[model samples]
Target: MKLDEYLGVIIFTFEHMKDIPVHQLKDRANPAGFEIKYFSPGSMRKEMELLGDDVDDHYLGAHRDDHYLFFLLEKGNASLMIDFQTLPFGKNSLYYVLPGQVHHSIKNEIVYGWFIAVDTMLISTDYRNVFETQLKLQQPHLLDDKQLQQCKSILSLLLEKYDSDVKSSFYIPVVHSLLQSFIGMVACYYSQVNNTGMQLSRPLQLSQQFKQLLGRHIRTIKSPSAYAGMLNVSESYLNEALKKATGFSVSYWIAQEVVMEAKRLLYYSELNVKQIAHHLGYEDHTYFSRLFKKTANETPLEFRAQNRK
Candidate 1:
């Protein structure tokens, strides 16, 4: 691992985890040790129970060479950073990391916390919609002890629901709701900081609705113009803002996402090539296959077989 890379696999996050064919998170390298793992509140509690070290929570760890997302639910002073930014974060305040963000520190203190392994798919969605919004809000901030306590309480409750050993359908909705509310809270705060100085009523390009839509339909829709229309923006302006920040044009960005999803479906899912093509909203399956081959350098089936082997 090097710097600013993104790794989302859970077990490989231990820093000491290997890079064999069995555990390859990606072909690329990242910063050596900074990794983030998402865990349910129940999982954190279970970890504490298993470790028998609730009082020994003060310690430092970070992503070795990649961007990570971690929400800590503990107390005491520990520096959480992602690259040039470092801020003391704990149950007292909210801390986040963007892609290529690196952080780690453990002052002599104690509290409880959980590690959550975020899905790359989710992160990709955030990248398209919330990445800049998050980056703009990037700063290690302090919260009043009371505010921090409240944040921790909310996280703890959410984790408790998520980490239960006995899985239930009901838990699914509850966890989803908790995560939505929590991220929304963070985004609201992000807006307060970035939107405060110079407000833009033109609406956030990555509107919450657009985020949800992109997350749901990126596979089917592969044009910035379509997304712009969905958000009631003209294509030219959307492209201008997107390119200004991300360097890629809007259609290109959409294609990138579509290609990624196509790879996943082609390599990970059981769907056949034609089915996968249709799933991605191409009525002309031949065109989809041609595009896939052009971008991937192998036929869909070939790519699947080679990777699976």
Candidate 2:
């Protein structure tokens, strides 16, 4: 996990997941774009021992994954740092890390859990909406006894399917079905906290769409009006809907997305301020520098220096 050599954020793809030293199914086919591994205290210790001097390179580092990551802890205590926020984990808890979000394991003390990573295409549209749009700030979801047991039972079955050496004609389909069931359970839990009911409102839907679009096009498209045009809504209407749904206007989120990426680049990449500004789609480096200072309260160089230290 050396961060200094990269010119941009380090992205861990599904292929990268396969090479993880702690992973159990190293010899088995992981199925396309899906991977699950069961970890316990002994297993974690053994993994660290196997890595020896290279342990630091594999664990306790920051990087972004290109797939959704889920954790279901049946016991013990753990914590994860995601996008700079420390999320605490305890007994019978569930946590999810969205794709492209920077995260690192903070601590895992005598932990027993299932770590599952799946591609975005595998997640149904409705479930993806619940994860990407409905939730404002994702935190650890503490499960009740019944919910915990249900999750455990399903994951147990999934583990069996995943670890099985026999591959039938329907193996992939069966595994996918089980994966959907597990993800549906997770989405249901999150939707309850969102309180948006079964059906999302139109304004909220628009805001969600706007956010998704902003994530994809922030570097190329910078104006609120441009986004509105692409979404077939007026700029003022988009602003109003975004304000109601997120308490922030489209412009604010656009700037935030840019600044967040800027922070990632400044800290993780070796690129200088001018190159970084250009990389982020700003032609004039001075303007980009001003925007970074205004949004992040520090010049790009200062931020890089502080974080590097």
Candidate 3:
């Protein structure tokens, strides 16, 4: 099939993968740098009517957002494909999508929730650490009765502040403070579930740092020794720490990261194998294909063909 044909099919199914789009929520007039939106059964259709084509684009197709996205699903069911993995969001659960993670809604019906989009600068470092670094998978967390009541109270107050008409001097700060509280509550819940205590052991800390570095520099830096040098640890020591913390060697993670990214690109983009290889810092497309086959147990084309909707 032609690439455009492939795009249309994958646009709805993994088999017909196409180029992914990126969504952003930045407006110069909105100095608050955040937006709070409520969703219900008929709300999305109404939004499509009021907001026009942009709203449709927001709902359909695979796309990544430039800002952090959070959802508090209070009723009904919803699901989404994040980084090519399908995650189901049940009622009274909280789910977050980190910036730059490609995702698209797979299902949304009779849903009642508050959707939030906030700039990266607005999220404090500690909160970011909890949501971004500590909760790597970004899945849904079912809220207990107390937690649900707490979130509802905070959101009620926050929505009031967000829609307040009184233009006081501390208006924005108050809104932001309320928003921060809501985020902190959610962060605490996840932190407790993830068991990311206040103090991490030395080996786990090193492993966490190494994983973060691997995510950011994987395209340009692939050598285990190079990672060890960057972390200021010897190669043997780095491998030992990684194995202790994650039960995997440094090389295993490197290959895993590379293949995961490659799969994402292959399943979402129109890029050819050669271009994708070069995009991954491999000048030799042939070698990259070999590596992918070794790691994924299939050639690039085979994977694309097998997984595409």
Candidate 4:
């Protein structure tokens, strides 16, 4: 099934649960623009029950979402797997999952949380860079009591506006403003906890821009010098700036991006190894397999067989 259909199944199951009501900014008949969803603990549990024999069993396998997800666990404990990294979270913790990320619940013990799913378009490009690039190296934020309370207050207000009976014209603006504030707060905390201060130097800014561009053109542009040219900077200058800011050369980052995309396509797409290689701009399937093994410590087919659910 297509990714959207899988997401529909998950959403449809949640919509039928006892106390969880999925709120959408747009009407189903004319779905357009970014959509937002809020899920309470009761709804989450009910949806898990709808999916499998037990709540824990239901979410213990890998799955990918087509939208961004922010999960705030107010109480209890759970282990989450995102892109092969196992992240353990407990009360007062927040986890961000980007679109197309391979993730799943590894374990849960009476977990109680709130989940907000936002359409990618709804999130500003600045916030996306913060989330996808800057925050990728960090772990989940375990907020202090004060911070937790502040987040709860924002979430409560957001839900209130979301469920309000006000007219669309009024409600939309209010909720939109609140949503941006909420996301901004999260980004601030993420930056704080990750030790990457909010301010960006010129080199760091260029590094971020380069990463974004590489994400867009990774399959076609495999040369760091080409990326440097595209960014209108000399290759040596680009390398120096990137190394100073990110502790890695541009080539290392490019190779990492390629391997990451290869892993995603291998796990989520039905294309075979050769087809996957060709799709990723490799002419030789054997060379692609060798590169995948060198980067990921496993062959493409082995990785796929082990990861695909």
Which residue ranges in model 1 land beyond 4 Å of their true spot? 1-211
List model 4 lDDT by residue over 1-309, tens digit each.
111111233332321332212233233211223333444345445554566653333333445556677878888877766666778887898878776566655566665566666777778876875776561444788889998888888888877777666566677678778878888888888766654444778778778889778867988888889999999999999999899878988888887888887876675456678887888899998998998898889999899788754
C-alpha lDDT of candidate 1 relative to the true structure: 0.50
Q: After superposition on all CA atoms, what RMSD does each candidate show versus the true structure?
A: 12.5, 5.6, 5.5, 6.4
Q: Where is the poorest 10-residue window by lDDT in model 4? A: 1-10
Measured against the true structure, the TM-scores of the candidates, in listed sequence, are 0.43, 0.85, 0.85, 0.79
Candidate 1 lDDT score at position 141 = 47
Better of 1 and 2 by lDDT: 2
Residue-level lDDT of model 3, residues 1-309, one tens digit each, is 111111111233433544556566774115678877666666546434543443222235676667788778888887777876888877898988887677776665567778778888888867766675441366689998788888988988888888776377788889999999988887888888776656767777777788778878988999999999999999999999888877889999899889888887887777889988998899999999999999989999999898764
Query: Which residue pairs show backbone clashes in model 4?
Result: none
lDDT per residue (tens digit) for residues 42-107 in model 1 = 434443345343232211233332333545545444554334234555454455654433334434
Scored by Cα lDDT, where does model 3 land?
Answer: 0.74
Winner on TM-score between 1 and 2 is: 2
lDDT of 2 at 232: 98
- Candidate with more favorable, higher TM-score: 1 or 3: 3
**Displacement of the residue 153 alpha carbon in candidate 4, Å:** 1.1
- Clashes in candidate 3: how many? 7
Window of ten residues with lowest summed lDDT in model 1: 1-10
TM-score winner, 1 or 4: 4
